[model samples]
Each structure stands twice: as structure tokens, then as C-alpha cells.
Target: MEKTWNNKAWFMVLPVLLLVAFSAVIPLMTVVNYSVQDTFGNNQFFWAGTEWFTEMLTSERFHSALGRNLFFSFIILLIEIPLGIVIALNMPRKGWGVPVCLVLMALPLLIPWNVVGTIWQVFGRVDIGLLGHTLERLGINYNYVQNPMHAWFTVIIMDVWHWTSLVVLLCYAGLVSIPDAFYQAAKIDGASRWAVFRYIQLPKMNRVLLIAVLLRFMDSFMIYTEPFVVTGGGPGNSTTFLSIDLVKMAVGQFDLGPAAAMSLIYFLIILLMSWVFYTVMTNYDAER
Candidate 1:
């Protein structure tokens, strides 16, 4: 028997296609146009052809921001992945506690990124903020506004608090989807907790772990609002990652061509790195 294809489904997707074209494709083309052209105000354009791209690639400031972005992403993955796995392992797999735990995990994820930043900004002020006041009262020096290290630390902790829950939820879902029979077999085999986790649980969670890492990496790489709100890209440029630098170039200085070039490079780097991560992880998983 031959199957009939429903061509009407294309009509249903037409609106979504148009939306994407307007929202994403059009804006991307605008950036590409800006990147390769020079404008001396009044809607005038001159073909510059790779001048901005070459400058961006060789610029020390751009390199520094890119390094900071890479370092931040690495730290985030290192901390969140292990911490999430531990939390997922300890969570009640099936009980009244399950919904409670899930709700709590989801709460931080629900908060707006800017609100999280504002909350931290207020919470870390030495004069009036609870955290700052307590640290000062304890005779410990803690000031995010003037201290670069403090700003970086506060940002990292805030990110962990806000985003770790996503990893936990993803890992927990992977854990729960696992068959009870697998656990039964392990128990019967007298498998140690460590062995069971290493040989079975970790392997089972691999796919979801991949998803969580990619999501977190992309989000962290493109991070702007929280750090911008909290640190304002500083304790004097120390916390300025690629996103912040891009904003400063584009809006702060209105250097359209350089900023546009930087944005394209920024996007390509994320795409390349994410592809590398996916390939390495999937291949490693397959080997196992």
C-alpha cells in the first residue's frame, strides 16, 4: 500500500516560517550588510570588504574578551555538571518529595535574568546589602563594586544558583526514564553504588547531559544581561566578556562595522565550539 502525504501541513507551518524570516533571517542579513560596509552617517555606505573582520580578529581587546568568555564557559561546565549530577543522584526518584523538589528546582529557572542580576547587585552592596553587610560585620572584606575578583566570584555564584537547577532537572529526567529492572539487576549482582553509577547511570544519562551542557554553554557564552546589570562589565573591565565588549562597541561607541564584524565572529565561534563539543561527546558516548 502506498501512503498519502499531507501537503496541507506546509500551510500550517507557513506562519512560523515567515516569523523566523522576519525575526532572525532579516536581522542577520542586516548585520552581514553592516559588517562588510562602512557608513559615514546619513545612511551612506561604502564597501569596506573584510577590513573590520581583519581588525576584529587581530585586536587585543577582542582577544581578551574572547579569552574571558572561554574561561567563564569552562568554569560553568566544570562546576554545574558535577553538582547537578550529585543533586540528581540524591533526589527522591518517586515520592511526595518529587514534585516539591521539582518545583524548587524550577523556581530559579523561572526568575527573569535581569531580576536575578538586580537581586544580586542589591544583595552584594557593602553599605546596605545583606551579604555585603554580613561580610563586613565579620571583618571580612567583600566589595563587588570596586573589586574585580569579588565581581567575578559573585557572577559565578549567581550563575550557579540560577542555572544549576536546569542541569539537575535534565539529569533527573534522564535518571527517572531509566528502567527499574536495570537497578534490580545491579542490586542482584551486588554492584557497588560507585560501580552502578559509573557503568550504568552515567551512560544512561549521557544524552541528556549532552543537551544540558550545550544549552548551558550557549547561554553562558551569550550572557550579557546579568553580568551587565550586576557588574556593569566591570570592576574596571575585568568582567567584560565578549557580549559586553560587543555591546560597548556597538551601542556605547556606535562603531557599527567593527561591532557587526565582532558579532559575526562571536556567532561563528559559538557554532564551531558547539559543533566540536557535540562531536566529541557523541563519539565518546558511542564508544561506550
Candidate 2:
């Protein structure tokens, strides 16, 4: 017998669809409009075609910012993924330690993004901050406000401290889901700790690791607030990643056309890279 599908569910989804269109599609269309047109005062817009796109693609400023963004994301993923896994592995799987570890891990994540930035900003001051004062006493010349390298280091370390907890939670969930029989069998087989981790725990964690990697990558790539607050994209332009530069253009300089074009291009790069990551991981999962 043929079954009749329930079409009434679509009505429930129609409101959500409209909401998304209004929230996302409308704003995106506005950006697309600005990207292909030029406007001065009085709300008059002139068609500029692809001129902005070409300029954005060739500009050294754009290139440098893009490079910084890619480098930051790479470093974030490299540091956070492994660190999270290790922390998760060491966390207690049972007893009171479970709740304690979870609460501690969650504390950082609960803080506001701007607050995290502010905390790090004040926490790294040479005069009053513990880190800077200790480093100064140790004879290290660390001034993030004046030194480019120090600014980068401070931003990276701050980000790691703030976001690594997310990875730990994801990895911990994956670890806890593994059946006890797997560990019992490994023990019966006289498997070494390394063997158990390599063959069993690692494989079980792969799915969560992929999620962790993707989330961290996107956040790092799109990061604006924390680094901006800490470094102000400064000690020159050393910390000015794409998002920061784009904001400088759109809001600071009020260059609407080029900024809009750059925004679209920036968005496309993110989309393309995310697609590549998803595809490669999916294929690897299939192969395994």
C-alpha cells in the first residue's frame, strides 16, 4: 500500500523560512547592492560594476590582512585541538571530579566576548597586570602596546585561554559516549595505554574533533572583537586581520563600495575554505 505524506508540517516551517529570509536574505541583498554600486552623500548610488572587486583582489592591504587571518586560524586550530583533547583525556570520567571539571571548563565560555578581551587587555598591562609585571621582573621586554610581536603573542594566548574550553567539552562528550566494553576488551587483550588510546579512544573522538576543528576555524577566521580590543589592530598594522581592516574601510573610512566588495570576497573565501575542510573530512570518514 502506498503511504500519504503529511504536508501540514510545511505550514509550521513557513514562518521560520520567512524569518530567515527577513533576517539573512534581506541584509545580504543590501550588501550585494552596495558592493556593485558607489554612493556619496544624499543617498545617491552610481553603478560601479566590478571595479571594487578588482581593486580589493589586488590591494596589498587586503593581501596582508588575509594572510594574517589565515595564520591566526591555523595557529588557533593547532593549539586548541590537541590541548582540548589532552585536557578531556585527563578529566575524571566518574565521581565528584566530573562536575568540578565541567564547571571549571565552562566558566571561561560563559564570560562575554568583550569582557574576555577587556580582562586580557588589563591583565597584560606592565604596571598593574600580573603577567606583564612578572615578565618585566624576569627581564623580558614585553610591551604589547608598543611591540608588534608582543601584541600578537598576547592576542593568541588570550584567545587560546578563552576558547580551549569549548574543545575540551566537545572532546569530553565524545570520550564519555564510548562504551565500557571497549575499554574492558582492551584490558583483556593486555593492550597498553597507548594502544587503547590509539586504536579505540582516538577513533571514537574523531567525530567530535572534526566539529571542534570546524567551529574553532570559523571563529578564529572571523575574529574581530577580542584582538581589536586588546591590540586595536596596532603597534602598526601587525594585528589587522581581514575583519578589522574591513571595518576600518566600511566604518572608519566610510568607503562603502570597496568595503562591501571586500566583505563579499571575504565571505566567499570563508565559504570555500569551510567547504574544502568539510569535504576532506567527510571523505576521510568514509574511507575509514
lDDT, each prediction: 0.94, 0.94
lDDT of 2 by residue, 154-229 (tens): 9999999999999999999999999999999999999999999999999999988888898899999999999989
The C-alpha local distance difference test score for the whole of candidate 1 amounts to: 0.94
**Clashing residue pairs, candidate 1?**
none
The residue-level lDDT of candidate 1 at 117 comes to 99
List model 1 lDDT by residue over 76-194, tens digit each. Answer: 99999999999999999888999999999999999999999999999989998999899999998999989988998999999999999999999999999889999999999999999
Worst 10 residues of 2 by lDDT: 206-215
Candidate 2: which stretches are off by over 4 Å?
Answer: 1-14, 281-288
